[model samples]
Target chain A: MEKNRNRVIIASIVIGIVLVVNILPFLWLVLTSLKTRLDIFAIPPKFIFDPTLKNYVSAFTKRDFLPMFYNSLIIAVSSTLLSLVVGTLGAYSLARFKIFGDKHISFWILSTRMFPPIVLVIPFFIMATQMGLHDSRFLMVIVYTTFNLPFVVWIMRSFFEDLPFDLEKAAMVDGYSRWDAFWKVALPLSAPGLFTTAILCFIFSWNEFLFANVLTAANAKTVPVGIRGLVTSRAIEWGEIAAVGTLQVLPVLIFTFAAQRYIIRGLTLGAVKG
Target chain B: MARVILQNAWKKYGKVEAVKGINLEIKDGEFVSLLGPSGCGKTSTLRMIAGLEAITSGEIYFDDQLVNNLDPGERNIAMAFESYALYPPMTVYENIAFPLHAAKLPETEIKERVGRIAEILELTDVLNKYPRGLSGGHQQRISLARALVRDADVYLLDEPISHLDTKMRNRMRAELKRIHSELQKTMIYVTHDQIEALAMADRIVVMNFGVIQQIGSPQEIYFQPQNLFTADFVGEPPMNFIDCRVKIGQGTLLISFDDSVFKLQNKEKVEKVANFENHEAQDFVLGVRPFYFGISKSITDSERETNFLRGEIFAVEPLGDSKIVHVKSGKNHLLVEADSRFMGQPDETIFLIPDAGHLHLFHKKTEEALF
Candidate 1:
């Protein structure tokens, strides 16, 4: 009993330190977002001060942050949905059928994700310019989908493989076609995995800055690009930057928390057999 | 209902032949069992019949129509998987109704069929519960209910109740037999349990090493096995095999093993042994089931003068209704099913009398039954 109590105390102390370390910066950012310009630059950082919404007001009015936010939402949502639809079908095919050279093909798909994004950015920039597709939300969506498709295929393939093959066979024997078996039985059973994959894809696309920075300009600027725009050469608008950063993190936070239950189960699903 | 026929059915999983060429005809409304040990290709044969697997090079016919190119759905079959593959997201009621819904039946009819099968399977109370949290037995019954709720040409059940407790398994066996009788649909049941095959199937197909060992009625399989594998695999306290040599002397044949000799008094058996005498191989296996052996505590002069063999008791297992006595004689060990009141001690002298009419003889080299 005594040893357990001491272990609990040590564990709680360690967890407390981890929580503070991770959350402290986000808390400070939110605080700075609500502060005056001078208060943001205050020495020692004021713990208690009257907060103002001027930074947020200027962010929406003068910075054209609303359109940028809309651009990010459109690109992220569209790209995530597109990747899921294509990746799920490919993953199920790989999981169920006897494809020739299946291991090599799957490895090739994963190898696409292994290439550093910076290496591809140059070629992508040239292609976008040559095709006159630069500075468009369509280009952004396509780029994000290409990058996220490999991850979706890899994760969803394992999820499909973990399912008992008998379910689909039973469904087919019960008057369902192969497609119907996959849609009605396999897809529904993998709901948790689908949600988990969707959230991760959405977050990856939402916070992406490098590809958006090179491929997008005035009309297609996402939240991250807009936040970078706040760092001007003459004087950095720290307050506005903090405001945009808080707003940028809000949607991802909501998405992750909403799918928190499925995320936990989906992440640890294949560790134990039912 | 349809008459299912397989003409030289074979299944090959890339170079490894899971089911060698097999031919069978299952009449409409007949309950046939494919019985074998694991990896004997019994399950693969059932899957091929269900159209969930493709035959390597053979023809399958349903009611005289070739169904080689048909899909599983097009074959109009219902199968209960060994894995109890109930949809995790659907409730028991929905799972049972899925096939009916796929058939485009009326909602009222779907509900009625699902409800009746669930009640019959004792799954009515768990109709609204998902499959993930149910017990294994409950999940298994739900799979059975789903398969039975549909109107299909054939019902393929692959070890549906193999995971249930003994009492439940017996009860399900009776229930399934009754259901087959009522529905009058061709059903192919697959199981590794010999008792299940014997108790339920009208005809049992015993398989070994991807080949059919024997196909016969339960009584024929029990009393008149055609091969050593069938005789050895079918019995509960399994048949004891004693290696013996056939010695023909003075127009009478005597079977000798170790220091014991017994007369082959049956005229037909004697003729069968005489036919094999020209092969230059005198070794044969004598098979006798436990129930066919009579145990005596002491050998009488008349008993010793006939078919009795001397042995010493190894152990005794009392099973409430009968006791199984393990006896060791020379180089052979045998089991005798004695009466419940019979008391025997280990290392005590015992004599086992073989019923001459029930003995089986198989060639030791060929493993084929001689009579």
Candidate 2:
């Protein structure tokens, strides 16, 4: 009994340290966002101070940050939804049917992301300019999809494989066409996987800045680009940058909050037999 | 109801033939079981009939209509899987109503059908529960109800009761037979258990190694097996096969084994075997079911004359209803099903009487019964 109590104390201490390590930066960001510019530059940082919404107002009114936020939302939601629809079908086919060289095909799809995204930025920029589609939300969605599709397919394929073929076969034998079987039986059972894949794809596309920075000048800038825009040659807007950082996490947080229940179930879906 | 027929149907997975050419005719409203050991292609054959698998080489017909190209849904069949395969997200009612919903039936009609089947399966109380919360037996009932709700032409059940406990399995077996008669659909069941096939099927097709060993009624398959495999496979303790030499002397056929001789009384039964071994002594095997042989503690005068086996009791296996006494004669161990009250200890000398009418002769080399 004594040993267990000691172990419990040690475990809680370790967990407390981890929680502080992770939450401290976010707490600092929130504090910085609310601080006045004069207070931000103070030699010793002030943990307790009068907070303000002035930085948020400046970010929205003076810097025109709403369009960037809107662009991130449209791009993330559109690319994630599109990737899921296409990837799920591809994944189900790869899981159930014996397509020739299918394993190699799926391997190639995942391998597309191995190279650094920097190598493709130049080519994407050149193509966008030639097509006259540069600095537009359309190009962002398309580029984001290119990176997110493979991940969606990779994640959803294992989910489909985890389901027993008997489920679909039973549906088919019960007077359902093969397509109906997939749509009704297999698809609904993969709800957890879909939510997980969608959240991951949305987060990746939401936070992406390298391609957004290189490809867009002003019109299709995302929040990450907008945050970088707070830094200028004349002066660095530290308060506005911190404010943007704080705002950038809201949509992702909402998306996750809406799907939080499925996330836990999704991770452990195949760990036990149904 | 429809009759399902497979004409030389086969299934090949790349280079391995899982099901060789199989021809079976399942009559309308008949219950036929495909019985075999695991890896013997019984499930493969059933899947082919259900259109879940494509026939590698032959054609399948449903009541005179060629159905080899029809999709499983178009074939209008219901199947109960061994894993149950109940939709986990749906409640029992919704799961049972799924097929009717897919058929675009009216909501009231779907509800009525689901309710009726659930009542029959005794699942009405738990109709709102998801599959994950139900016990194994209840989940199985829901699975069966889901398949039965639709008025399909045929029902295919693949080892549906193989996972249940013994008590539950016996109950389900009776329940299934009652349901089959009530529905009168052409049902093709698949199982690796001979007892299930014998108890439930109107006809049993025994298979082994991708080939059909025998196809017959339960009584015919039990009493008159055409080969050694069927004889050994269809019994609980299985039939006893004893090696012996056959001789015809003075117009009388006798089988000799380890200083024991049994005179063949049924001449026509042993005539073919006697004719096959003309002019020379030949090695043959005699097979008899344990139930047919009687054990005596002391050799009587009639047993000493002919058809008497003197051996020592090797082991006694007491089943609840009966006992199986293992007797060793020379190098062969024979099983004798005796009355439960017949007490005998191991290593006690005993005599086993082989009834000539129940004896079976097989050619040692070919393993084919000589009748």
Candidate 3:
């Protein structure tokens, strides 16, 4: 009984420490976002500062954040959907049929994602300018797809591989053609995995600053670039930065929490045994 | 309603041959089992017949129509996979009704067929539930019901009961036999388990290393095997082998082995052996199943048993109604399954006599069956 009690006490202490570590930053983000500039620098950073919505008001209205939000949404949505269309077929083909040059091909695709994104920016800029797609949301879709397609193909391939080829064949034997079997049986069953991949792909595209800054200017500025625009030359708007940070991080947090189950499954799949 | 014929069918997975030129004829309303060990191309053969895998060469005919170029859907064959292939998103009713709906059957008829088959598979309670909500057995039966519900030309089942527990496998085996009798549909099943093949199949095609060893009814494969591999691979404990040589004495032919000689009967067989009169066989493998050997009271009870061997009991396994005794005889060991009433103590001397009818002779070099 005493041993069991000791174990419980130890567990509770560890759990308490974890909870504080995980929640402390968000609490600080909220607390600092609400404080005035004077209260923010009140000697030792006061815990009880009077809250105000001035930072949020300035962060939203004056900053042209709405258009930036729309840019991020458009690029992220289109990129995610586009990757799903092509990546799903590629993934299923790799999983089921023995395509020619499959292993080298999959490895080559994965290597592109592993390459430093900064190294590709120069060439990408040149190509985007030549095609007259520079500073356009359309080019961002292509950029997002470049990174997301590898992971998307790999993730969907694993999810499909874990599923036996028998189901699809059984469907075919039940009078469904190959394409019909994929759409009717294989694709629908892998929705949770697809949704998980979509959220991650969207998150990557939304939080991307390097490609966004290099590729966009006035019209197609994403949230991250918009947040960077808050950092002026001399007087830095720390309050606006905090508010923008909250906005940038909010959707991702909600997305992660909403589909946390699938996210964990996807992460484990990509990390191990994949 | 269907007849599946494979003409010199071969499957090559990049030089490693999976199915090597197998010719099979599965009649309408017959249950044929393709039996072998793992990686023996049994599944490859079944997939080829189902139009799932392409035949590297040769042709497959269904009811006198060439189906080599046809897709699986165009073949009109129903197949259940080893993995229970239930669409996880759909309800059990919907999964079962999928084939019927694809064939453009009426909704009412689809519901009726799905309901009846579900009841038969004991899946009626899970009709509204998705496949993920059911147990492995329930999901497997649902898959089976889906395959059986469609009135296709042929049914191809690949180790349908391999996932079930032992008791369920036996129960399902009985159910399958009953269903086959009632439905009278052409079915081809694949399994590596010898017991499953022997118990459930009307005819069996035995294969090894991508070659057809033999094709025969259960009795023909069991009692009269075509080769040494079939004799060894078919039985439960499997047939035992002993080295022997043929010698003809004055007016009698005898085979000698392990310091004992057995008089060979059948003058015609002896005459065939006499053909090798000058050219003597260095050795021959004597094949005998455990059931062919019987235990006597003692080594002294040898009466008319001329071809007798003695061994000390090593292990005694109680098989409920019978005791399988492992005895270490001279130069070799032998298994003797005795009556359950007589459980011989270990290390006791046991004399064994092979039943004349069940004894087998084989060529030592080629492993071919000899008379």
TM-score, chain B, predicted structure 2: 0.95
What is the per-residue lDDT of model 2 for residues B111-169, given as tens digits with 9 covering 90 to 100? Answer: 88899888888899999987787788888888888888889899988998887789988
Ranking by TM-score: 1, 2, 3
How far residue B190's Cα lies from its native spot in candidate 2, in Å, is: 0.6
For candidate 2 chain B, the 10 contiguous residues with the lowest summed lDDT are B273-282
Ranking, DockQ, top scorer first: 2, 1, 3
What C-alpha lDDT do the candidate models reach, one value each?
A: 0.90, 0.88, 0.85
Model 1: runs farther than 4 Å from truth?
A266-274, B277-280
| Model 3 fnat value | 0.71
Candidate that would win on lDDT: 1
Clashes of 3: 0
Give per-residue lDDT, candidate 2, residue B154. Answer: 91
Quality of model 2 by C-alpha lDDT? 0.88
Q: What would the per-residue lDDT of candidate 1 be over residues A88-132, giving only the tens digit for each residue? A: 999999999989999998999999988688999999999999999
* Chain A TM-score relative to the true structure, per candidate: 0.96, 0.96, 0.91
CA RMSD per model (angstroms): 1.5, 1.7, 3.4
Against the true structure, candidate 3 reaches a TM-score of 0.90
Docking class of 2: medium
Give the 10-residue window scoring lowest on summed lDDT in candidate 2 chain A: A265-274
A1-274: candidate 3 lDDT, tens digit per residue: 9999999999999999999999988777777678788876788878986799888898877778888999998998899899988998999999888889999888987888887899999999999999999899999999999889998999899898976677788889988889999998788767778988889898898889998999888878998998888779987787877777788788888887888776556343321121
Q: Which clashing pairs does model 2 show?
A: none
Clashing residue pairs for model 3? none
